[model samples]
Target: MSSAHYDCTLSLTDFCSKETERVCKLICLITSTGTEMLSPTGFVVLSVALGFIMTFGFVNNFVVLLLFCKFKTLRTPVNMLLLNISISDMLVCVFGTTLSFASSIKGRWLLGRIGCSWYGFVNSCFGIVSLISLVILSYDRYSTLTVCNNNRWPDYRKPLVAVCCSWVYSLIWTVPPLLGWSSYDLEGAGTSCSVSWKVRTAQSHAYIICLFIFCLVHYAASDICM
Candidate 1:
């Protein structure tokens, strides 16, 4: 190649390298600063909201539990389902909402990958248990109006079985992500974590679809029909 042309080509190469390095450094800076995704004011707002939810939820559910424990009349079969719902809600506030509230206060997730996984799994499990308990409560109310007394199961046994089944059903859906059907990651302003809903892989897609249909739609439809 001619000398002039070689020099021009070398200049172009150097320019490209510098530009690439600058871009990479910019990306690194953005990623390193967690507050870039959410303004400090926004984080404060989230923290306030989550803190309110955690406090009110914990106190309200705790009251219900206390009442249930203190009173014999409140221990009826129908009330058992309500107790189960209260238990799950209290746990979610403790294990799930509290972590998110703390992260929101700092404007970032502090628990790393393992904490994110725990937050996702624990929240999902307890949230679903609460949802299923509501559905069961609805069914119990409906059955009381429509079904004969002879068709109903024994009082305490039925609610006890349902409470157990709600936990099991929640486990069935939430455990798959831990086993690699999908995974958990930070989401929504980087302060909270849950199932990686943005993943487009076939496995992740399938799990999300099944989770939506079985855990969400099925329960909602059943409740509506009942």
Candidate 2:
């Protein structure tokens, strides 16, 4: 069997920093809130899992970011869009997955309902940003070959415009989840949470379908790129 990347024995909650240890003695350090729903064993398991995922994920995104930054040859508009995607993915690894996991322990959200909304909102935003960034990237490449193309993105301005649009699109995808159109469930262990897949209003299904179609298009586009 493969060894886990983290010392799951310690867990993210029990792992200390001077910050939280100061305010709430019962709470562990470096967490978003004071919720402890996981058994030591459950937390160990989760921490081990998240640690491994983030370890691999963070490294790859960081490497991708470095490659984009370091290689002057890769400084195209598409690469710029991809760099935004990589950074968003990195933020999800760094903030979304980890903080949500830490705060979900003990079942109830310790971050209050507003915090919960923001958490879901931010995670969804990053997710959509990653997808939209890729979509924009594909278009940037395809535009170069189109016969009617009057101007191709030749500077930071165009890439910046694309990046802004990516964020706008991502915000559209994310805001509904926060408005209670999508649900958040404290899955089994308190320290874990997800958008409630079981419950759905009309918009929820539409959102899911929209995401599915977007994903399928990207998958096809990526295959073509390959």
Model number with the top TM-score: 1
- Position 39, candidate 2: lDDT: 58
Give per-residue CA lDDT, model 2, range 1-226, as digits (tens).
Answer: 5432333346445654667444334433213232345656766677778777777888999999888878899887667887898899898888767665565343344676656666666677888788777766776777666746556545678889989987887777666666666655444455545565445478667767776666446545664773
| C-alpha lDDT of all candidate models, in order | 0.86, 0.66
1-226 per-residue lDDT for model 1 (tens digits)? 3222222223344434765665444444444432235789999989999999999999999999999999988888899999999999999999999999999989889999899999999999999999999999999999889877973444698889999999999999999898899988878788788898887799999999999999999999999999
TM of each candidate vs. truth: 0.84, 0.61
- What lDDT does model 1 reach? 0.86
Clash pairs detected, candidate 2: 37-105, 37-106, 104-190, 104-191, 105-190, 105-191, 106-190, 107-190
Top candidate on lDDT is: 1
Task: State candidate 2's TM-score.
Answer: 0.61
Q: Cα RMSD to native, each candidate?
A: 7.2, 12.1
